[model samples]
Each structure stands twice: as structure tokens, then as C-alpha cells.
Target: MSSPTSIAPAARLSDVHVAFDGVDVVCGVDLHVAPGELAAIAGPNGAGKSTLLEVLAGTRSPRRGQRAVPGAVAFVPQRAAIPPRLPVTVRDVVAVGAWGRLGPWRRADASAHAAVARSLSRMEITELASSPYASLSGGQQQRTLLAQGLARQADLLLLDEPTTGLDADSSRRIRSVLREEADRGVAVVCVSHDAPLLEAADRVVRLEAGRVVGAPRT
Candidate 1:
């Protein structure tokens, strides 16, 4: 049940422009991501990489442009608002990914549980399935967020600095998960400073001062 865009670019931004107040962040940039491709948004701090991702996520509407980001998009933001001592468990958090089909109660069926379990294992957080979401460390929480994203079965995934709190092993695992997703025809666009992750991307896009200044990936 895919749309025409499935054959088109998974995401397409034409003459995209984003600004905060009087300052322009993303200016007249045209970018496209095909299905089964992994593209990395690379730049130094203040390069508007995250802002661009927000635009792609539909959280920030460009002041002017045409956006063609496909459906079934999953976004794992850099920082999430987590309440301390919440009663929700790791499995509950990851199950959010299937909410579109399973509903909030997660009473779908055994397949839903299997999907949740698989994502937990992929993120190496199966042992924490019963653990409280608020009880996990920053790295652990990051991994959980990633696992949640993986369980979504999204056609397009937008991740912002997904490995911020990860160690070498964790980072490697995350990269592997992203690669597997792209291989499964998921278009992955991640903003990262992690060297290995960027190296593993199918294409690399460079941004500077809010404009795509280099790279054929975009």
C-alpha cells in the first residue's frame, strides 16, 4: 500500500527555506532521498543540521518551499522530554512505534510483542524491558529511543544526533541497525558527528551555514 512517492524520492525539498526571526537557517536547498538509501547530514555546530531535520520531520514548516517527505516517517529526536520516576517500562516506550497500527493500549497481538522483543534485542535492551523508562541512564535511554524507532516499520527515519550518549560498542550497534533498515528499503537520514556512522552511509551530504554547499548525496 505504498504511494507514488515510493517510486519517487522518499523525501524531496524544493527551494526550502527555514528561518528563525530575522535569520535564515535553511535557504533555497533542494534535497532528495531515495528509498533504501542512508544519507548522513554532516556539519559542524551551528550548521543548521538539526534544524534541517526538523524541517524534514514536519515539525518546522519552511517559510517557503515544497516538501514531499513520504508517509510512515519516524523521528528520534536528540533530546526527549522524560519525566523522572514515570511508571512506564522500556517495552511500553518501544511499543509507541506500533501505536499507529496497535493503538495506544498495545493490545494488537503476539506479533506486536514479537516486534517489540526484536527491537529490544537489536538495541541490546531486552533485559531492560521491564525496567522503568525513567530509571535508565542517558546511554540506555538513547538506545531505547533507537529501539522504538526501529519498531515503527517506517519508510523514512529522521534521527538527530542519535549516538550522542553512546559508547563505541553502542555506536557501532546503532550504525548496524540503521544500515539494516536502509537495506530493507527504509530511507534513513541521520544527523551525526560519529565518524563510522557517516562512513557507513550510502551517501554523504554536507551543509554549511544552512545551505547544501557540497556532496552529491543531496
Candidate 2:
């Protein structure tokens, strides 16, 4: 983890717009996330937080505006689609983060294995590294997904309602990890309704009807 020092911006969106089925989801939203900063997005249900995150992740193309995402962007969706009967272990799931950088026909190498171990340790899930991924509790599963994201060495992390299904303790643990990441020069953007979790952010942006309703402030 890098020290909490001044760093460059990891992502910037200028007049970004996104529409789904001819319905605007994000309208002319301008946002910037600097390295080592944690920015929280809060809004009512159907405020388009998830849609904006998907656009930022490059998974959903924007309808307009210039968007720049530096380095790798890791996104943990609200509900990760994990196979209920897959024969994968926790460590194996984390190693999937390296798939994008792997060569064709290549398997997990020593470096990838080491990264998986380190990510699990950082998420405090080393003890569950060998557990069947589907057998873990919801909170544990969320932690494993977070480890997968961390293993990718992502410069920008976009979490969509990560604490939705988590208990108080689990939510706190996850928020602590996110804060630690922000301190390490990783831009963190979390879309959540959790009031307590918002305190970890340096700024908060409120969205409504696919547009920013007010100036983002601390």
C-alpha cells in the first residue's frame, strides 16, 4: 500500500450521460476521483447510482461526454453472480482477477498465486482461502469478491452498494478496508445508502433523476 500522499486523479467524467431504453440514467454528471480519496455517492432508490458506476467501469457505454479512467478499474457490483455449484475455492476465485492479464492457455503462476494470497490476507480472509466459495456466508462472500478486486491491482475501485446485505460489523470491516485502500492512493467510489459508511468519505455526491442535485461537499 502506498502512503497517504498527494497523487494524480484516477478517473474523471465530464458532462457524462447514459441512457437505457431511451430513458436517461445519468445526465450531464461531472465527477473526479483523485488518488487516495474516498468519494461516496448517495441517493434514493432508482437514482441511477449503479448505472453511473457501470459506465465508469467501462461495462456500460455512455451516451455522451468525455470520460477517462486511468489504470485498471475494478468494480464490485451490488450482487455478484457467483455459481452456486461451481467447484471453485476462495483462493481460485480471487485469482480470477489476473485473468485479464494472463496469456492464452496460461494458468495461475507463482506471481498470480502470491497476489491471491496477499489479497486474501489484506481482506482478512486468509483463513477462508480454501473454503468452497458457495458455502461462505453473504458477508464472507462479499469479502472474497473484494479480495478478487484487490488482486487486480486496480487503481480505481467502484463499489455499488457493497454493504447492502451486510451486518453492522461486516459493513464496518468492509468500510475500513476501503478507507485503507483510499489511503494507499487507490481512488474509491462507493454507492451506498449506509449513513455510517458515508463518514469514511472525503466528499459526498447526491444524485437524483439521473443528475447531480447539489454540489458535492465534505
Candidate 3:
């Protein structure tokens, strides 16, 4: 992985603030994530970690400050955002990531299929490709969602609580995949409380009451 200072940032936020129902969730935070770096946002519940990620992802606009992101970005929200009863297969769900490039009417072609396959393999869910997404375990579903994000072939990847509630092996696999993605020159950021994930991250941004208390490493 290249040194963070050697390359331009893939995502940057300056003096960012986000509020919900007039209550501040993320306040006066600044962040920068460079290509080939894995950054972890760690905080307790209600600390605004997920909201900060959304601001970086351009999904939720901030109440104040600036966000700059260039190139394709893939965001995988918490598992609850995906309906458990959906009838899509694992492969079907992952293939949707390519639809952005395939456009609305175009059908999936060879390259699209290859992208989905590669993503599934990276998450170690290739064997579950044909299975119904709704039938999988929480860990399996999380991996599938991550694979979907990877299928985007994005320059920046953001995830929320990916290893929450997952078994040890699942968490380990996810951590490994994150490292691999960073090594492949994708900027990766995840909101997580998991110790292993935080420990493995190249940079850990600690948040408290929506404020960044420390960012100790590059």
C-alpha cells in the first residue's frame, strides 16, 4: 500500500456536522482517507459513527462544513437496511452493483458477471451465489452485502458495522477482506466497535459525542 501522504485523498470531510431532529449527531469533525488506506471509525452507540460515514458517502448531507469525494464510491450500510424477506439470490443481489455501470436497461454481460463472481469469491461467498439471500445467516448476508459493494469496483468503500454480531471466523474473514481491498489500492472505511477490526486498521479515528477525540496514526 502506498503511503497516505504520497497520494491524494479518496474522501475528505472538513468541519463536518450532521443533525437529526435538531439534535447534533456528528459535530465539527474532519476526516481524510487516502487510496490504499483502511480507516476505522470507532465509537459507542449514538456516537454518530454511522452518520459520519453517510456524510462521507454522500448519502446524507451535512448540516455544516464540506465534503469532497471523487471517483466511484461504494457504501454498505448496516444489515437492517436490507429486507430479510427479499426474494433475491446472493448472486442476483451482488450483480446489482454493476447496474450503475450497466445503466437501467442494459442486461448483464460477461464483464458484469465476472465482476460479481470476483466479488463473491473475495468475500468467500461464491458457493452461496445461487442461494436465496433471505435464507442465509447474518454473517452470510453481511458478506454478500460486502461482496455487492466490492462488485462496484469502487475507488472508495464505506461500510457500517459489518462485523457486528458476526462469529469469530466471519469477523476474521471480513477483516482480511478489508486489508486486501486496501492493498489493492481502494480506500476503505468502516464504522465498527469490533476490537480486531480496529486493531487491524491503518488509521483509527476515535469519536465521542460526535467529535473526533483522536486520530493517532496514518
Candidate 4:
């Protein structure tokens, strides 16, 4: 196995800092995730884990620092971030990941549909494709979101609390899927407190008061 430092970075944050209303959330933290690596961010609730993730996702610009990420990035936010009672099916939600490649006016082509189908199968949610996304359990919703991220075929995959509050089996499945994604050369980064996920990570970055305190390996 290649060391994380040996591989070129798929995403990088240099002296990154984020603030909301003049209060800093992420403070001068540098991080880089290599392709085919699973990196987990762990910290207390207000430690700026999610804020740092948003910086890497390029959804939130840092007040002072640099971010380098690929154009093809897939971000799976916490379930609560998704609007409740959306009038869409599981397949429909997953299919939307392809929209970046197909512009606003273009319809999904054959290959795009194939990617959605493959993602659904990979996440073991093909059976739930026709199910209403809002009606599914928390675990099911998480799986659906993972499938959507997979469908994007992105270079960087960022997730927030993927296995939080999940049952044993669901958590195990999600962790395994994350490893599989890394093995397929996708840089996988997740903000999580899940022990199993952290234990399985190639690198675990711990943040305290918006700073990286340690980067320990299992």
C-alpha cells in the first residue's frame, strides 16, 4: 500500500480558515487527501469538522487560505440537510448526481442512467429504487445518498456523519462501502464520530478548537 504522502493529493487545504459572523470555525488547518485513501475527521460538535469539510467541498470559501479540489466533487451532507418530504424516488435522487455532467437543459443519456443503476446496485439499494426517499429509514436514506455520490464518479467524495445513529449492520455496510470507494481510487473524506469508521480509516484527523491536533493512523 502506498503511503498517503506518496500519492498526489486529490484535494488540499492550506492554512484554511472559516468564519461565520466574525467567529472563526476552522482556523489555519492544513490537510490533504490522496486518491484511494479514506480520511476521517473527528472532533467535538463545535470543533469545526463540518465547516472544514465545507471548505474542502468548495461550498464555503475560507477567509484566509487556499483550497485545491477537482471539478468533479461529490458531497453528501447530513440527512437533516436534505429537505424533508421531497417528491422524489430513491432512483430519482441518485440520478440527480449526473446533472453536473449533463447541464441544466440536457436529459440523462444511456451512460448516465447506467451510472445511476450501478451506484444503486453497489450500495445494495436497487430494491429501494422505486421507494420514496422521504419514507425510508435513516440508514436507508444514508445508503441512498452514498449511491448518489457514487453515481457522480467524482474524484473527491465528502460526507458528513455518514453512519451517525445507524444500527450495527447499517454502519458496517456503510464503512465497507466507503473502503470500497477508496480502493477504487476515490478520495473519501467523512466527518464522523463513528468508531468503526474511524478505526477503518487510512488516516484519522482530530480537530480541537478548529485546529488539527493529531493525524493518527490505525
Residue range 93-181, candidate 1, lDDT tens digits:
99888665465655657777788889999999999999999988878888999888888878899999988767877788889999999
Per lDDT, the best of the predicted structures is: 3
Question: Which stretches of candidate 2 lie above 4 Å from their native place?
Answer: 1-7, 101-107
Q: 1-218, model 2: which lDDT tens digit per residue?
A: 33223455688889998988888889999987788888888899998888888888999888899889968888887766877888899988888886644646788788877888888998889999999999999898888888888887789999988898787777888999899998888899989998878876888888998899864555
Query: TM-scores, in order shown?
Result: 0.91, 0.91, 0.95, 0.95
Error of 1 at 116 (Å): 1.2
| Candidate 4 overall lDDT versus native | 0.89
Segments in model 3 whose C-alpha atoms lie over 4 Å from true places:
none
- Residues 1-218 of candidate 3 have per-residue lDDT tens digits of 77787789999999998999999889999898999999999988889998999999999999999999997988987784557677889998899888765778999889998999999998899999999998999999899989999888899999999999998888999999999999989999999999989999999999999999988885
* lDDT of candidate 4 over 147-206, digit per residue (tens): 888888899999999999887877888899899989989899999999879989999999
What are the lDDT scores of the predictions, listed in order? 0.85, 0.84, 0.90, 0.89
**Global Cα lDDT for candidate 3:** 0.90
Each candidate: RMSD to true structure? 3.2, 2.6, 1.4, 1.4
Candidate 2 at 30: error in angstroms? 0.8
Clashes of 2: 0
